[model samples]
Target chain A: MSRATELVLADYIVVALYFVLVLAIGTWFGKFTKSTADFFFAGRRFHWWVLAMSCVATLVGSYSFVQYSEVGFKYGFCAMTPYTNEWFVLPLFLFGWFPLMYYHRITSVPEYFHGRFNWQVRFVVTLILLVYLQGYVAVNLLTIGRIMKGVFGMPEVYGAALMALISGIYLHAGGQTSVLATDVFQGLLLLAAGIGVFLLGIAEVGGLAEFWAALPYHHRFPFARFNTPPYLHAVGNFWNDAMTATFAFYFINQGVLMRFLSARSVREGRKAMLFVVVVLMPVAAVAVSGAGWAGRAMVERGILPEDVDAGNIFVAVTGKVCGPGFQGLVLAAVVAALMSTLDTLITAVAAIGVNDVYRPVLPGRSDQHYLTVARIVAIVSAVLGISLIPVFQHYDTIYQALSDFLSTVAPPLAVPLALAMLWPRFHARAAIIAMVLGMILMITALNYPALVTPFAHGVDPSEGYSHMRSLFGLVTSLVIAVAATYLVPAAESAADRLTWFHIPRPRPARRRARHDIWHRRFRVQVVPGTDPRLHLHPETMKELDLQQGDVVYVCDARWWLGGLRSVHAVVGEPDDTLPRDTVRLSEEAVRRGYLKPRHRVILEYEEEPIDV
Target chain B: MGPWLPYVYVYGVGGCVFLASLVAGVRAGAIDLNRPADRRTLLALVAGLLLFATVHAIWIWAASQEPPVSDQAAVALTAETRA
Candidate 1:
């Protein structure tokens, strides 16, 4: 008798154990929350490192594993486009935009909209976010089911419900705490499994050089053919992928923007982002590309039948190469990844319901009631997600589904959010109309892509770039938003340029005879988001007794607080009071750049307080 | 699939347990579950390690069963029929 193989049974048991562990964790967190904030955003106490891992867990899902693996199996090394796109999103997140979030104090994208435009703008942005998020939620549910079917041989419907039930119960049980903390665990597991599978795959194929040699020429090199049609198609596809992903909403993503606000210091947030960029993002390359290589190995090994669907690529590879115990572990990792992303969407959707929907619909509810309602909303969303999975059963790829849904509102929102932040004239009416028009044009182009052939011109749509949606949406949103802002600028009388935080309590504002002078001194200096210990002068900050990154406006124009905006934070001089003892240095001294000593230069602004 | 991975996830699992205790309160109305959550955290981690190792073992066996990648003629023949 063949020895009873414990492999498959062990794998199932392991998957079951992983789920049970997740459930237990959720149950444990369910015991106590200090307050609603603890439930919602971990009391905003997560370190940057924690936040970074959570980000990875959120972005690197089972769908992505499958998406990349399929690409690898089909195209060999040419399957690097998505990996290339992942790299492109990093700099914008790391260097270009997120630092502003640490400086500009706001909660929720809507709050920024209110500051720049009005309540109308906030509503529009919220609606757009919901629309974009819904698609992601639906697709994730679909992925959960497909993963079950492929890896465990569960039926599609049962798999979908299983995911919905498991994710919904735990998500409702712990809220953001479960999502965040579990993400860290999930991210680590997924990363390690991915790297192991890839290394083994490369070895199986006799290393990278040997693998490349075995592949056909075009399969090994994707972009070698540079004809006009193909080249433009490639260029546009790359831009669409990067630009849409990188566009800052208000200033940054709410999930991550909150990390800075919760940061103990600006230094912590900076370090946290740096850690992610340096450590985690590189690891992500292994997951995406390694899965691809594993896919190729599976195909070449004849483990995958010729008739298998492209979507089944990862499932086949993982099943054929990894034994019972490892297969269960790998399957669990896939589920973890899928759940990691899916839970983020569910939490965000619940927040919308809690803050934006339930509270408004029934206002007098207690905080306890609000919390209960939030949990219910998550469960409801999961149910809806389950219902929607069947519709996408007809679609080809999960990642492609993600793109189609996201591409809808990205262009309109990207333009308005950026413009509203930098340009004061970006008014609400203009924003609303532009967003609506951009969406309409996008849908039209997606349906009748031929209408966009002048732009896509001889490019094939079936290759699935969906260029018409991205390009047309971009053109329409920019044109409409910019024109509306310029042509119909909001009434000067209607717009207010003050913030609640800046509107000081008058009693404190008038306390000292030197108040006017102090206000004038602090006029041009921005309240930096970074901690003085990290970004400001050593001598001056030690004595101030003020919190780092807090807005401390004195009367005189002092360069010590950094640039025109709080984001450009660095120390400029030693003291606002001591002109003689002052260390006069270059402008970079006040912001994050090199400072060379130069003759002192000063900026001018109003000394008298504007009517508050 | 080794011992190290479960170690990496320890912090995350512990944190999740601590967080989930609050969810139990919000849902069923009483949340003195932190004690049990802590216990579960350890159990979950141990279980996870075992699971990963098992999957790896299965993968090795499966790899042995599949035909070698060097069978070029068979691959070409399959490709022809699929097309």
Candidate 2:
């Protein structure tokens, strides 16, 4: 057989074996994924070693291996710049954005979103995730497509379908366990393959020593680009613009957040994130360098056909450098990288649809039923995602398209989420309104870039126009809600905020209207206490029992155990009463949210009032 | 080279069959084709993957590279021209 035919047979055997292995893994590990939480996040008790390895494996997906490698190989010796973008220390947890989702404190991070922002926002956000993750789901298929077509003349759809079959099946069955285990094993395989490429490429192109000596400049520093800015300024406007691309743009990334949220603790999530920072850096550097070296080696050797794209440097290196049987191993390893990411993307969107949207609409369902639906959703998503892969093949890199898509959607949700958690002043109504308006403005702004051209190049100009729109909505919504609150009497009682069913009837004023009337009228009495208007805690002062609409009075203030605690009262209600009337009656107070030490002090009145 | 190759041969046929099977399954109204696993099945899996990587892929890659890029004289002209 000719080389292409030999490669065809070899790739198929390995890919077939790869598929069977993943299926068997799903069969083995699927037993563990028995519940909603397990299906959602691997039961949050995933083994530490498994987590560390999985994280290492996960960072090597379709984009990192394919697009990132392409960039490195084509750029000559300067390919390390992209690796610099990978250096962040997992800021999701440090910023407290994930809360305890990965920490196992909460089952799903979006569950917190539901509590923080209300159900409508939860449904809308889930819709956005499902729409955006489609890019991620498709990119994996394309990565393997490049490998298959470049090496063996296999059609792109063949590779895509093969991926769809293998990953979709096993992921549908095994869920998180299959994903983690397969990722770790595949990660190690890919690493060895990578090292092979490096050694072989360098060996072919004059040894490493000669290669380094021949270069005009032997530059190895990752961050030297920072020292001398490209533009004619102190820090250079270029570096600042790129920082938005690499730094700020990364924080709201969907994939990284999903990975971090899978960890078992705040600290574990931190550990997992930090693991990527440590392991991925050198691996990435070497991989990119290896690709570049291969490009040079192939040209130096003159072995690549004239018809071949330089993007095939990796596949060419693998096919020519490795023996027939072992080419299968490289194929398997790369396919796994593609599969791991594709599976995660598909699984995430499915979980979003099943858990966030479908479950809420139909509140009554068995875990098994939801599991069944999750599998179905995964299958449909895979089909749709696979079909979309070929459409985006023209982009310079798959990740740019993915990133721009995320930049549009993630910014709209990120602002309202941040405000809900951090800003105690944010009301639920304001958050909902802001998010809705933000989504509309963002959709419009992203769809029409020409509208933003005047501000796009300015220093303070928002990086992505969608991000700018979200901020605009956040400000406008806050102002409207705060002003609206003042127009109506502040809800003086927490009961007032409660539903109409919870409101209390007026008590009888005639003490002897009937004998033992209280027993027949009401079973329980709610006592009114002094409202504490001033709460000074490191955390925010949240809504307690008393509202700003009630009659206000200083109930008591004293220093207890070296800490100041005070009780004030809403003495009266809106018979058009002021929030600060001691003479008013019938309002309740409850202390809530954060409290500082020695923060509340009561004033002592010296003499009787004029009414007394 | 043994059953793995012809099985792969059969797999190429089988893959077509599998794609055909997917069509058939779609016709059959089957949403997916996965099943649960047992202890024995799981162990077989771990062993297979280990063997595939350690023996098959590595042996092929390492043995093939033993000759190195030095074997190709055509590369010399391109290398010299670029230099």
Q: Candidate 2, which CAPRI tier?
A: incorrect
Per-candidate TM-scores read 0.65, 0.58
Give native contacts recovered, as a fraction, per prediction.
0.00, 0.00
The most accurate candidate by lDDT is: 1
* Superposed Cα deviation of residue A399, candidate 1 (Å): 9.7
The DockQ-derived docking category for candidate 1 is incorrect
TM-score of chain A of each: 0.72, 0.64
lDDT of 1 at A183: 76
Give the runs in model 1 whose Cα sits over 4 Å from its true position. Answer: A1-7, A30-32, A84-105, A150-157, A218-233, A248-266, A297-311, A360-369, A387-403, A461-465, A491-612, B1-83
Tell me each candidate's i-RMS in Å.
17.5, 22.9
lDDT of 1 by residue, B15-38 (tens): 343334334322332222233422
The 10-residue segment of model 2 chain A with minimum total lDDT is A603-612
> What value does the lDDT take at residue A326 in candidate 2?
68
